[model samples]
Target: MKNIQVKWWLLLLLIISTTVSSCEKEDSGNAGRLTETDFMVAAANSDLFEIQTGQIASGKGTLSEVREFAQHLVMDHTTSSNELRILANQKKITLPDSLTEDNRAIRMRLSGQSGVAFDKDFIEVQITAHDEAISLYEQATREIQDPDIRNFATKTLPILQGHRDHAVMVKSKIDSF
Candidate 1:
């Protein structure tokens, strides 16, 4: 009787292990591809970082143009964040609440500057960030498998390009000064 009980327990364990392994295999297929959840979380985090850095610039920048750009960043990114949140909710995705570690470090560095130095650093950072954002959106629009996210990326690329163009103009002005 005890031997029979042990055999049954072993069989159950074997079945459970097999099921779990198959599930894992299915879940991890195409590990190189970016998932929808990954895209959404990354998008949300980017918005948060931009908004935070823009707030810092608005408070610390001495240049009127820089302050105005910062305000635009805060407003535009905030709207994008809200739209992303609604889409994530509709899709049952949970986005992260804070910036990534790298972005937080950028924010920390930006927070330490003042006056013209702050304006230059802030504009430089914005240009780099916007360039990255444009590239990211372009990649997502081209490569993302999820249709909704791909569409979102397609719609966002133009705005990112505009921001990058504005940043470039600002950098040219700064160089002339």
Candidate 2:
């Protein structure tokens, strides 16, 4: 009776182990060809560009600070986007030339507003977008299967975090003003 119980316990453990390992394998994305990661990176880059251009072009907020943040976004995201472009090209992942419809619609909406209204709205969007981006980067840092893709996420995470922090600070001022 003791032997039977031990065997059953062992069998359960084996089943659980197999299940966990299989889930890990599937989550890693088929030997890390980077299809999903690349798509996400490309889309993120497009959104960054869309927001940067729109804000810089139509921004009415404390122009000095908005200009500073706009410049940083251009510099940091452009560099990261270029790295992503290189990786995508090497991995043969297709890259898009423009932002998706949803992001474009957001940019158009921001462009339509003016003065403090536009400033507040744009800052809020930046805060929300950076927060979302931080989470995405954090997940990619863990779940990305390819060494290269994982490294890119790791390298870019601090920069994204900084952007998020700056955005939050600016947002508070924009909101209060």
Candidate 3:
């Protein structure tokens, strides 16, 4: 009878342990990634980087097409950034006023180049940045816990995808030249 009682107690303990473990796993997952505040900051930094790089290309690019593309980047990214700022303001989220360290490094590298080199490097940067932006917005749309942020992501994703497609096309043209 004691052995039977021991077996019942062991089964209960096993179930309890599993339940606690699963709960911990879920909590840690939320803590680990895709937090709303982190998403906002990242988005803002990307916008700032795009704006700054586009401004550089506008002045330094030898290719007229590259200059035109840079103008588009400046206009579109400015609009997106303003909208994001408004949203962040409404949500009481503070955004970074400058680019992240990685983007600042890109800006410095692009600043050192001019003419054809500048044009090529700027196209490459746009392609990579837009790709990353698309992925980030897509992930936020899918997994963000905050309703306002998720909705924003869903609305912004198509625009980011469009930018990515444009950048890819521009990169291909640059490669062919």
Candidate of highest lDDT: 3
* Tens digits of lDDT, candidate 3, 1-177: 999999999999999999999999999977757878888888888889989999998899887778888888889889989988998999899999988889999999999997777888898889889888888888888778888888888987887777777777777777777
- Model 1 per-residue lDDT tens digits across residues 64-94: 7788888888998898889889889988999
Each candidate: RMSD to true structure?
A: 5.7, 6.2, 2.5
TM-score, every prediction: 0.79, 0.73, 0.85
- Give the local distance difference test score of model 1: 0.85
Winner of 1 and 3 under lDDT: 3
The 10-residue segment with the lowest total lDDT in model 2: 50-59
Candidates 1 and 2: which is better by lDDT?
1
lDDT of 2 by residue, 1-177 (tens): 999999999999999999999999898766654355554665455546534554563445545666577667777787787788788788777777677677778777876777777767776777777777777777777777778877888888898789878877777777676
lDDT-based ranking, best first? 3, 1, 2
Better of 2 and 3 by lDDT: 3
- What overall lDDT, based on C-alpha atoms, would model 2 receive against the true structure? 0.71
